[model samples]
Target: MKLLFSLTSLFLLICSTALAYDNEPNGFKGLKWGTSIEEFKNVYPNATLQKQQPGEYNPANIITYIVPINESKLSGITITSPFRYSFYNNKLESVLVTFTGKDNYETLNKQKILLNRMSMIYGEINESSGNNIDEFIPGLSTSYYNFNYCWKGTTTTINLNGSYKEPNLSSYLSISISSVEIRKQWLSKVKPIDKTEWSKIRKNIISEYRSDW
Candidate 1:
């Protein structure tokens, strides 16, 4: 009996390993990492491009495109949620899908479908939690979220999360894919500004100017 149990355990472990390693190439909706902005538009003509104003944390001239679900297609599935694509330095870097509606079950079903489809392509989910609300406050009539799902691959990371807020139910899913070099360059462009250090530098400059006078 002991030997038999050990063999079964070993077999299960091997199968799990195989499932984890079995993944499709790093791409979503026919758009691969490093796809040019013009190429993305050519593929999805209905997508609307919008430029975000540069800020301290996001110094790069980041541009985003909103692609309606009706215009884009995911293999073996149909989703009606809008997709938001962000591009930095003219290259696609991330994609986001958000769903908000009155029906909680419907939103959850949709999220499940999406996660299953992504799993088929990206292999078994890396980590997941919070599929349902943990607790509800009666007087305030508020629901708390304990829900999040995530998957990571060699070149991409995907997240699916849902939350319920009083009147409406909402869910969010996103994938970020990029090559190591591209990610490094993008990070360099959007590095956060050190506010405290900046203040100190400004103060020093001001003090120096007063002394010079």
Candidate 2:
């Protein structure tokens, strides 16, 4: 009986791992991870570069593009055109867009409403915590956050964060999507590279990603 139970547990473990890998987010929007820069220019011809030209032949490893729009609305929330596409070594890495200073609500209830809307599409929340009204003192609601939610895939992380700090103040919200494999190598704690293979190791990292959580 013990042997049969052990076999079942192992089978379940393997299935879960396979499911996670299969369902991992491969790309943002229409593009996939490791896409080249040339394709970006060809597809999004109007994407404006947000970098100063390098002094000489050294190419910029980190590049960002800001897509302009008269007005943009995401998830029924009106937003402006400051969406971003950030890349490292000409490969797409992450996308981030922050919305602030709109005619939005000044209450945490609005955030709860938005959270419900997102949960419908993204499924479950991975991990979330925030301060409640009871946790704050008699009058320190400005810094109190009602809630936060995060959804995680095997290789991608999506975060929804932002809130109002005061009455009559703008409620800001930021949504970010990113690749985790790239961030992992960035924060890897391996020993120093060998002098004999310094160039080879550097090339490998330049091609690979080092992401941060």
Candidate 3:
């Protein structure tokens, strides 16, 4: 009995160590952000910035930023939340943005702070769009749009999108899970997003991004 108990404890210790290592975030090596147009072009050798046409509402047209990761991949960030100041006003608005590249999952995960600000902007849009209070709650109305990142080797494609509802001053937001696919061909080799290990990575990314705010 003593020997059996020792073996069990040893197994548990190994399991715990494996879990901790798996949960740890894989530190990224080649990611950089550019705060200005010239800096962006310097990092992204082929990037170009263009001004918005008169009377056009191109949110990204104002600022130019770039991120270069890996040999043949690039990422960009454009500050598009027009209702940035209404975060404290309890308003509603709409948000639209895009990300592209292979390792963008980490970069996008780091963008949750921006997303929170965009949510505030969405609150403003809902109010200006004349959404009736009876029809929808100000803080409750939110939409999430995302295109799945392609795996290294797979023909299958995954698309993810959802809408969330969180009433004003509420801590918990209700997310409408529109679609989730985890199959052998595509996302099987990649880590599952809902898993606990991925959650830890996500939490760390958000904490780092919001450190200033």
Candidate 4:
């Protein structure tokens, strides 16, 4: 009975996690990941792909687009911003959206709306807060916070971050959604350290022999 109960619990946990990611979000703006550059161009015929890094980099290609600011034109979406897409292995890996404008109550409200929209699709989010300052400019501090949401099925992560300076004059928000598998595959290709070899080196000791001449 105990084993059966444990099995049942495991099944329930798996099901709950699966249900959390009912919508398998791949890309934004009608674009999906794992699509080749040619395929992307077919969708957005005039879209241009810019190479930001060397071919060795995981995200070697990028495309930035400006979204319309007219709320009604965007169908009641006021949080219009530019989106940057990072492509790896000829496939889209991450999408970063930047919300611009002076930091104020209005900006915060828009951010809240964006978060709500994302939550509806990505599920509950894990929120966090932090502080950031310009190292060169002293006394220039800002409040920085972010909401991170993840899905188990696709191992995708979505991060919504906001930063604002004092007096709410300068503020901006950024949203990033990335695929975990793509990141892991790319990161693994970077310079990797051999822990076992490092440990051996750390334990190696030179014998001290006093030579009396």
User: What's the best-to-worst order under TM-score?
Assistant: 2, 1, 4, 3
Q: lDDT tens string, model 4, 66-175? A: 33333421213445454456667777666666554444455555566766786677566543334322121212434423222334444555555554444454455556
How many clashing residue pairs appear in each of the predictions shown? 2, 7, 12, 0
**In order, what lDDT does every prediction score?**
0.51, 0.52, 0.24, 0.46
Mark the regions of model 3 whose C-alpha exceeds 4 Å error after superposition: 1-45, 48-135, 139-188, 191-194, 211-213
TM-score, per-candidate, Cα-based: 0.59, 0.61, 0.22, 0.57
Candidate 4: C-alpha RMSD to true structure equals 15.8
* TM-score computed on alpha carbons, candidate 4: 0.57
Residue runs of model 2 more than 4 Å from their true location after superposition? 1-24, 51-61, 101-110, 133-140, 144-147, 189-213
lDDT of 3 by residue, 21-134 (tens): 111111112211112334334445654333322222222122322232233211223322111100001211111122321222332342343334434432221111112222
lDDT of 1: 0.51
Residue-by-residue lDDT tens digits, candidate 2, 1-213 = 112112221221111111122244677768876777788778778889875322211122457787764487667765544777777767876676655444334334335555677777677777565555334332344542334456666777666654444433334455666666653443243343455655554444434422200
Pick the TM-score winner.
2
Candidate 3 residue 143 Cα shift, in angstroms, is 13
Q: Between candidates 1 and 3, which one is better according to lDDT?
A: 1
Off by over 4 Å in 4: 1-22, 50-76, 126-155, 191-213
Model 1, span 1-213: residue lDDT tens: 112112221221111111223564455678887888999999989999654321212345557798887644454344445777777788877665554333555555555676677767667777666544334321244453434556644566555555443333332233333333345566565545476955654455445433322
Question: Which pairs, if any, clash in model 1?
Answer: 130-146, 130-147
Task: Give lDDT: candidate 4, residue 156.
Answer: 58
